[model samples]
Target: MTRPIRFGHQARPTPDDDLDGVARRAEAAGFDVFLIADHVGHGPAPMVALAAAASVTTTIRLGTYVLNADMRNPVQLAWEATTLDQLSNGRFELGLGAGHTPQEWAATGIEFTSARARKAALAERIEIIGRLLDGDSVSVDGAYHRLVDASVPRSHQSRLPILVGGNGAALLGHAGSHADIIGLQGLGRTLADGHEHSVRWTTDHLDAQLGQVRAGAGERIADIEVNVLVQVVDITADAERSLAQVAEMIDDGTTTTDLARIPYVLIGTVDEIAEKVLHCRDHWGITYFAVRALDDFAPVIDRVRQLE
Candidate 1:
């Protein structure tokens, strides 16, 4: 099957930067989506920043790349997301995740919970948030969240697209069952000091993770949009050298060959990268890609647009 491809640019806006101009540039650069990351004390708030982007741009879709479920009440988050969808005139896609960063929890004075706890909490929120976004009155007596006779303003879209991002089996399984978009983030393993583990960068590991999502999705797999966040995009004449550098950065005993196979890193000339993206869509059913907002990625966006 030939799946349709969509490109999203993930923008990190500092307080000193021109937010409106950034959104306008993304729309001009042939991007289909503009996404913001949710982090405390690192960048602007995701939904608030997207609201600013929504006011300036007319066509590019605006969204949080993935909001941490541990941070907010589900009912309140549903209201805020629906409101943003209304403000953006149905151009909003909601992305939610089980919280992973320990530093963010420390910074916010929120208790850092185990991965299992976070995933379970996220599952509950997805249920409540999904219903609320659909304009359903909900009353849930759950361990993590409680909602009594709650309903949010209906989203402009009959059902706003929900993107659930994660790497673990349980979390991806939940995403497979509920989300419109399933973001295949590689295994998100972080050290105690907030350093990323290189194991998450391996190709074999990602394939295994996707298998779990497939199993959980079952018959609904054909209806779901699969997405990957491209961590490295190097368009250069010396593709092998770029791959080597990425392999070293990942440092998980991964070879250049293995790096080449991983869909999340695009390292090649425009033609080569474009061909690889199409190959990935054909083989793995991944057509939605999110890359960091950088000048280097412009040609790649143009190339992917041509494929459509």
Candidate 2:
């Protein structure tokens, strides 16, 4: 099957004008979904930014690339996510992760823990989020959160897909069980040595995680969807370089990736990017394009539309 493209934006220097402009153009362009990053102190808060993006457009799906669920209070996040779901008319995906950034945790005053503990806590948070979204009033005593009573209004749409992001065994397992969609992430240190091992490792990890998820959800496993991405930094337009980066993602286990498209980040013309997109899709079966660092996403958006 031909992979469909979902454009994600991580434009750090992206101005509000660019944000609205990109959202308007992206909606018109037919790119499947548009995602915003959820970081501590950068850009507009993802939920609010997506709310704004939703106000300007009618159809393009909006989401966080991956929201740090560990940091967000489940009760508050449930309400916030449902609110965004309502505002977006049910076009939102909630991506969650147990990130390793101590700086962010330190900033939030969130307690620090070992990697294993962190992953365990993240799993509980996922369960809480899912239950709350499903209209159950929840009271949980867990390692991380202890809520007395929490619930959300009925989802405006069908079950909002919970997109879980992370690569370790526990993280992947958390996704397989609770998340409707799994965000396969990069686990390699560099992009030069072909991402083959990483991909295979991730695929294997998911297989293991899937077992846990299947056990947890019982009959609900069939309803889940798997989504993945490979992140990029300091993009250049060179086709070989870009291809290498994308290929690395494929090798690492990401069936999809963010296309780096900053003004000077990439070296080639729009035509070259189109060629690269075709190459990635044809060979690697990559279907998603979460854009990186691009100032105005118009050029990249147009290039993506041509594929459809």
Candidate 3:
């Protein structure tokens, strides 16, 4: 069965531009969703920025690409999510993640925990957030978070969609069982003290992660929407040359053929990219694709919509 394709554009707002204009453009450009990155230094507060975007756009879905769980208490997050959903009139999707990027924690004076601990914390938080969003008063004395008779304003939607983003097995397993949308990211390996790396671009690595998700999901597997973040979409006539350039940039001694197999890097003309998208949908059941906002990606979005 072929799932309908949904394309999301990730916007990193700068201080100089009009955010409302950006949201309007995304809606006009045939993009299904407008997403914002959550970080302390680089981007604006995702919830605030998305709320502003929500005010200007009517149809486009507004969401955080993935909100780090460590940053906010689940009860507070529930309140903010409910407000955003109400403000957007049910066009908000909550994307949460086990906080990566240690620097963000350091800069904010938040304690940096081990990856395992963070993932465990995220699992508990997801449970708490889901209950609160569903209008159930929750009381939890979890390892990381404690909620005492916490309940939030009900969301506009009957059940606000929860999207969990991760590449590791434990997090993906949790997402499989809980999330409405499962965001497949690169392998959660730390590259540096403050930075992380994802092997998600590789087909084999992705297959392994998908296995974890499937095993964890069990009967609920059929209900989840599998999403991929298209980190690089290079639309060019010379696909080989573009692939080579990208491989060199990655500098992992990866060949062009190897890069061609990676789902995250889509290099080719619009038609070729569309073919690859269809192939992925048919083979992997990945229908949701997100790419960084770029002029080159608009045509690909248009093409994918036609495929849908």
Candidate 4:
């Protein structure tokens, strides 16, 4: 399906930044969604923070950029999702991922399992969470989770949107088959620190990933919306110069042309970046974009809308 272009801002609230004001500003700046990340080290709890954001904003949607599915049991997560959805007047978008960041588990004393194991667990969690949120009495005997007569309060939206995010063919394929939205970060293997990833920004890699999504979606392809998390949004006349440092940091032998082509990095003036936005939708079927900061991406939102 041809979807309308949408913009979302991820709020990384520090001690000095006011969360409510940040959300309000995101709405005023024309963001379609205001998102928070789920992390133990930083930021407020996503559900609680989004509830607070809901109280202040009337239009902007609230979402978890993604919650770590490994840490959350499906039943409790579904209940929290339902409450947040109701409180937000049905604006909640549930974003889930196979947990990355081994340190998160280490800090919490949760066993940090293998990536393959985590992905398998996430798939099961998604199944349970969806069934529960749909007001079904779910009973499952799975390897990672077991539930008997499990159900949650139905969300206000009847069918709340679920966004599945992360990198991996298995996970993305499953997301394609099941999720309302598939989030692509164009990332590869997690690096040594556990937080960063090897850049998989090349078209070849992305094509393979989308092929997986397409294969999984099959006839349901038209119903799913693809979202990209843009790592860098530089509104500048000198695109190459602006991206030079980023290129150095990448260290993946990716060329300047590759950088220009990658949807994960937007480095140009508002008009130029807006053109790229349309191109992404036309070429890759990606209609939704989320960036880290509101100010960096707000101008492109207006420009993209105007161009659209």
Query: Tens digit of lDDT per residue, candidate 3, span 223-275?
Result: 99999888778888999999988887777656787678766878999999988
- Candidate 3 regions exceeding 4 Å error are 196-200
C-alpha root-mean-square deviation, candidate 2? 6.7
Q: Can you rank all candidates by lDDT, best first? A: 4, 1, 3, 2
Q: Please report, in order, the local distance difference test score of every candidate based on alpha carbons.
A: 0.86, 0.65, 0.86, 0.90
User: Candidate 2 residues 1-308, lDDT tens each?
Assistant: 35455555543424445778877766665556778876677677788888888888888888887787778888899899899999889988787877656667778898867667877888899899899988899999887888988788877877877887675656665566677776655343223432233333333443454465556556765565545453443324565666456656465334322333211123345666565555545543345556553444556557767765
Model 4 over residues 134-168: C-alpha lDDT tens digits? 99999999998877999888999989999999877
Residue 196 of model 2, lDDT score: 30
Could you report the Cα RMSD, in angstroms, for every candidate shown? 1.5, 6.7, 1.5, 1.1
Tell me the lDDT of model 4 at 130. Answer: 90
With a 3 Å backbone cut-off (N, CA, C), the pairs that clash in candidate 4 are none
**Backbone steric clashes in candidate 4, count:** 0
lDDT, residue 10, model 4: 87
Candidate 1: residue 31 lDDT (0-100): 85
Cα-based TM-score, every candidate? 0.96, 0.71, 0.95, 0.98
lDDT measured at residue 252 in model 1 versus the true structure, 0 to 100: 67
**lDDT for 258 (candidate 2):** 33
TM-score of candidate 3 against the unseen true structure: 0.95
